[model samples]
Target chain A: MHIPDNFLSSPVWASLDALAVPAVAVVSRKAQKSTDSNRLPLLGVMGAFVFAAQMINFPVGMGTSGHLVGGTLLACLLGPWAGALVVTAILVIQALVFQDGGVLALGANVINMALMGVLCGYLPALALFRTRWKWYGVFLGGTCSVLASGILALAELALSGIRMPVALLEASLGLFAVNAILEGAITVSVLRAIERLNPSAVREEVVRSGRATWSKVIAALAGVSVVLTAAGVLVASTLPDGLEQVANKLGMPFGKHPAFRSPISGYQINSLGGAWFSRAAAGLLGLFLIYVVCALGGHLLGRMRRSYL
Target chain B: MRYIFREGNTQDGVIQQLDARVKLVLLIAFILSIALLARPSAVQLAVCLCVLAAIAAAARLAVIQVLRRALLVVPFVGFFSLVVFLSGDGQRAWSILAKSYLSALTVAIVISTTAFPRLVAAARFFRVPAFLVEVMQLIYRYLFVLAAEARVMQTAFAARGGSTGRRALEASAGIIAVLFSRSYEKAAMVYQAMCGRGFSGTLSRAEWRPLRVSDIAILSAGLLLATVVHFISI
Candidate 1:
């Protein structure tokens, strides 16, 4: 789900980055506002739990295994902001320290797996849960969220420079439908467990907990995250996505270069660098920088919530 | 690596010593470079590989170690995007596949070099929002709990001789329902526990030191190299 560097243009990519910077901050703030002090520890524990759960690969049909990407699960327990933030952390750890995804594409990955996945999934699910059709809402909201994440992935790809042709889009959409169904089923199973635990208790624990300040802070963060996410969307690349098979047709200058000459060319925007170590270092720095900003924003939101209380 | 992840282990020495941040940045740069190279000249790709190899060597990573770790994605990528290879022109498809593989491999190198726990710590250090970090932590924690639950449920089903054909599917569905119920119950329990503590709106931990001068120096050098390469490629 992570978009590697050199995959897209700077103007578009940077725009997305710019958007993410504040989106995370605002959302973190919003999430803080809704927090209950008592729920803080539980949320913390849950965060760790989610991280661990991602590592356990469940056997699907055939020899391939798929891990649960419980975006909606977390959203259901905590909220959308928490879900987005948690997924972001997971992706960051996977890419930066674990090397599961590329550094340059960290922003894209965060947007796809964290921002889009959690936000889209959580919002609708929360809505549905709050609406008349509690059970059906859970199923439908979860399904939609997966679709949102999948579409976001496609969007990220396009922004990063994939030229999605009509045929490609159709094929990709078909594939996405399959992926969504599988993921949706898994989500439903997880949510049902959560529901049986007692939604009222879950709600009480989150909203009535002593961490009133925490809730405020979380809310503020959410506000910030949403703003940033929206901004990123605006700035995101307008290029075609993976569904677009028209890379050669896009008529971009570098669209049709000799392939054999540059095997490593696609990963990095620049290929003639002196040391991979240094480039990698820069990427790590950017990742850290992003985290620092987010943390600072969360801290501020916390303080603001405290003052309000 | 053993010191960081485990107290002591025979396989501890196999891990690299580079800070997680350093590895992260390098890998990112590697990925970005790959993404940007577009239709790279074969020579450029070779150079990129050399750089990757050098980093791997510096990190004391073996080819097999990295490949084995990275192979996890091959199935997914192959299942999903192999058509990009088989459907396109032979030369073009070869180019696309190679480019994509290099990109994936670059990421694999980063993962193989860095352990998961440290990676999470690094994410925290970078200042990801507390809410997000906390959820990541919880997900990781509950993953095992759920898996164990799933296993137990499956065993129970099997023991009851409910593991045949159509019944298996029904049992699977039933298992999902069971898993959901248990996880929810557990979440409620966990939330109650949190209320006892003085939890605030924000999750906090000791702040990490910002990137030092040495870190900045290393990063600058990398950025400079990338800038130069980007220009050359262009």
Candidate 2:
């Protein structure tokens, strides 16, 4: 999910960086006001924990391996604001220090993996946990969060001008689906173990329930506004993304070459009238995607907190 | 590896002499310049290479150490660069590959020459908040401890004959759980310890001076070169 440098346009990348600022600001304010001093250290430790978790990859089919995005888990353990902060920090450090992801792609990577992954997975989990069917919520929360995150991740790749064949998307999604289910199982097992070992510790340590109810909605709206504004600006302008425009100017569009055209090429809804509307719609949908998925991530985290609390 | 981040051994010669701020600005400019170089001319590449060499020399970083650390990056960049040619850009593709390598190399050089603590201090001087600076500090400290824990997990898994296939997955999962729980517990202990010692939200720093005029002059020179090249390429 960590998109590397060199593949994306500067505008798109810059736009993501711009979008991150407000969400970060909102979250930072929420975290500070909560006065949960315990949560601060948790942010640092959880960053390390997620960093470590990322290193231990499980075998996926076709001789490749996948690791946990853990966005949802972080959101569940911490609230969304802190969770986003923690995940973003981990991603930045991993890229800059560990050389794991591309530097330019950090913006998209955080937007997709951290923001989208945490919220989407959290929302459903919280809703489900409130019901009698805890396990069902766990399964659905984990699955949908991953599903949404995967879709958004794929879109990011596409927007960066890397064409994914339909077959490839299907295969990748299928693999991720398996990965998410197993991850879900692991999440459930870990939660159960933690519950058994020290229920009180989980209750005392986690910070999800503290998230103000109004924040959930505000974050969603803010995230959507950012995505739409960014996409609308890009679509309206004549400039292509940094890499794509560069490729075109160089007469070498790489993945944009005919052989690599995707079914959803351009991120535009062609059926819509006017280029602006099409792009605006795409931007709106993209933001919607990030909001829904990330909100779910927060939801899942909230549910976990309630269970222990 | 051990020398890269140990404290108080500021015997790194010229690198230690330069203001940390100067190094930070130059490193960032270097990365941006390289990234923006669409298809670098050989002259452009030569200019960058020469500057890199000069910086390396000034920092007194051993060529061997730089090369050793830089080699780990070869596999990652090598595989992707090879694909660049296959994308049908011909000569232009080769140029892109070279530019990317030099950019990555520039990043490597900056990190290698500067000590981590100084780098963090530099970041602070750059106005990165105290909270984030401390967070970065703690993460680095905990990384070693976590690595040791990871090693122990591997050893225990091997001893239990849990070294293959399904067992491997389970072992990995178990290790993750353990690390999560242990880190949480340790964090609680750390918070308690800090509280006992009157821990506040902000971490205090010892006295340090700002960048001197000479440091500013050097950074300005680097920036000037970058700006010239940027407009020329444009």
Candidate 3:
């Protein structure tokens, strides 16, 4: 999603812009290394192709349609570095020429869609394609890329301190999930068609055979998820505090009266005096409980599946 | 499909006369100032708009054209603002809409006054990589060509009684694949043509012109005004 200007707070956009400058530089350097004299024209033509392709929308059921984001597709065709560079150029043109995104938020847009989207899509596809499931990798890459972009966008919105409801966040995630599936299907179809017509056009880097240690990768991913969960709980615990700060800034009365106090109001035991320790204790306990339940469920399911097998 | 290009150079105006480099700098400063604004007041938004309008008038552009182009950002930003509104942040939602509109208007004014080629050249002046700038220039040039080809393909598809459905999506995918192949071949040919003309790796350009005193004066005045407007809280 193109983050329009003003949606992001000043600090958020400024830091993103700062991060994006070096990212663009690194991507440009990598792209230059991979390409030769033909690189400039090819990049240009590829960009034009993407621009033109986006104009032709495809139906996505229910009389609604979605255009190709092209980040994943480009990365699949060109290498990821070149792909990111092309997408960056497209974002620039979109911002300057079409005003599709905000000028000031251009860096955030680039970081979200161009850099992160390509790498997320490309890395997974690369790892997957190394195995026997090449097509599956392509599909997964496309879907994951879109999902990652959507998640990043959500994270940005939350970090902006908008204090959106949980339902809205879920709705956005659900929407992106649908979009990701569509993107995956489209990416698969397009990649297969390219393979049939001109096999060489598909980058070799994507399909290079390498031994991927699945267990290690899964462990790493699991570790990341656990860390992320903990971080989310921590953020959730501090959310009301942030809300109160905003409320105070706006001169609105908040948290003075009990708004239907629960057993654990604001992530703390109400019996406890709403201290930091109580909130932290409640949050950590909740996290541990969730881990225990998940581990137990997984162990039981694995055992059941083994019995059936 | 119609393509929008730069306007006439014959129109002698203050903004039009400024060096592209100076204009680019001023554009960045203005956008930065607008972006830095948090919870901008009505007066602040008005001041920003007035500045944009003044620039538009100085460049002798049609107010209607600039506004119409600026309005294109509304639906995209408006959709998000609506989401924010639904989520119970009314003030932030309005701020997003207003700030984005002003930002878009400012960009429209800058782009409308400056030629795209000169803008690209100005990017080069800022030490933006030559390859990136070259690719951007080529992309801008070939965008129209590829767009027309895509239009023709769409027409042919429709002429054959192509209807929207899963099949249309597959057909569109195939069309895009074919377009990629065509563009690839075209790029090869374009590269060959460039090679035939004793071409170097870089896209060569004429010597850069030094900024004039008037350009510096204009830039200083614009930055001064922008700085004042930026720090004036509410």
Candidate 4:
């Protein structure tokens, strides 16, 4: 799922590259500020461990085997922020040394696999790790992480104007679903086995049974927005006509002049003249407001809590 | 498994001697130009390819080898382009496939010539965080070792007929668990060793020399070539 160079159009890549630099900085800061300064070396060795773990394959039947994707597993072992930093380092090494991904596409890959994958994976792990449903949460985290990344990858490609037939899109989605399940299964079993072996390895972080950490709540909210954003795109792709009919019932005045003129007047880019364009425009802008709302609410909540303390 | 990057390529090439910072800037500008080009005639594509080949020759790398390495992007891009082709836009499909291939070759060539450690140093020069760069350096250093260890475990497991039953999954997890513990212990040892050597939070960088006039000349030439390619296509 590593995007190669030139696969993304300029706007998509440029904007993502802009977004990723700060994101990486934030996580790197967190990793540095983390209590265990020893985690620096641990991060590197853990990265190598995940990289090498790929060599040990799990048989998925029919003479095929798949290895760990490592995002969720990394989150389980290391905290998500540090885990994200490790994944980012792994990605850079992969791009530069192995040609696994393109240099320009590094930002997109980092956002998708490193940031989103680890955060989404960690949300579930945080929820389930101390409970009887610990393993199930791990499985869900793995699946959600992979699935989230895959959807974002597909959406980016689509926005790049790569037109896939509906059938191909569905087929790829199905493939991603299968891959997600396998990742989930692998994460569950591996974490379980590690828990059994060192007894204390998995419990290092697991013993933290406090109120959901401030960051976890914020990450969960961010994860929800990511899922919503992807969902908006998917919905716009598949159900635009129905949405439009509902819009008309509520009287958007698409061809009329009584109401205020929205920027994308008919949910379409003015320079473009396709139903798909309108759907895409609406999907992208619609959720952006929701994301902003989430951000502001989180900020206010954080401030209020800080003041009370 | 074999290591993918052949380290010796950085040893003798003239391209390898260029300032890593200059090369980094030039490579990015070149790739950006390639990505932004909307449509190029077949003549333009051939011209770009020839120029790329000439650059490879200048680097003392085989043009064919760079082409072959760049073809790694084809399977991934080809599938997308094939769908576009099947949808009846052969020209757009070709543009997507060919342009991305050219861009990939450009990246592969630059990376081949520059040592990754040098590149990391360049990245740091360009404002990548000190800690992140250090972590990346460590990961690259240990990658081959851990990969080899993993291969040995996989082979041992396979030899023991561990692939047949449902137990293989658990056993595979066990392998990763063991790997995790070993890596954890190794990291502890590494930290101690580093601290023994008067380690600090940051790693030391390579000795510095200012970029020479030749570096600027090469960069200008590269940018001019990128412009030529863009306008030539236009």
> Of the candidates shown, which would achieve the greatest TM-score relative to the real structure?
4
- Per-residue lDDT of model 3, residues B68-117, tens digit only: 77887788888888878987779878988888888888888888777776
Report residue A214 deviation for candidate 3 (angstroms): 14
For A216-277, candidate 2 gives per-residue lDDT tens digits of 66755654564454333333222335445545656764654322343435546788755434
- Please report, as a value between 0 and 1, the fraction of native contacts recovered by candidate 1: 0.29
List DockQ, one per candidate, in order. Answer: 0.26, 0.30, 0.27, 0.42
lDDT of 1 by residue, B1-234 (tens): 011112111123323544667655665565566655545667766666666666556556675555455555455454334444443434544454555667766666655665554555565665655555665555555555665666677678768875444444445655655555555557677766654564444445645556667667767675565545544442
Report residue A240 deviation for candidate 3 (angstroms). Answer: 3.8
* TM-score computed on alpha carbons, candidate 4: 0.86
- Highest-lDDT candidate: 4
DockQ pick, better of 1 and 3: 3
Q: Report clashes for each candidate as comma-separated counts.
A: 125, 22, 0, 0
Task: Please list all clashing residue pairs in model 3, or write none if there are none.
Answer: none
Model 3 lDDT tens row, A123-197: 677776757888898888888778877777766666666666666667777899999998888888888877788
Candidate order by DockQ, decreasing, is 4, 2, 3, 1
Per-residue lDDT tens digits for candidate 1, residues A1-309, read: 454444444434544665576776666556655665545445544554554444434455565545556776677666666666666666665554344555555666676667767755654455445457665656665666566666666655544334444466668767666666666665665555455655553354223332335654564466346545433432333333321333344544443221112323332325445444444444444445555665676678779879999
- For model 1, the superposed segments whose C-alpha errors exceed 4 Å read A1-12, A37-41, A44-69, A93-102, A123-132, A159-161, A164-168, A181-190, A197-309, B1-15, B78-96, B123-126, B134-170, B173-234
How many clashes does the backbone of model 1 have? 125
lDDT of 4 by residue, A46-69 (tens): 998999997787888888888789
Better of 3 and 4 by lDDT: 4
Instruction: Kindly report which residue pairs in candidate 4 clash with one another.
Output: none
Clashes of 3: 0
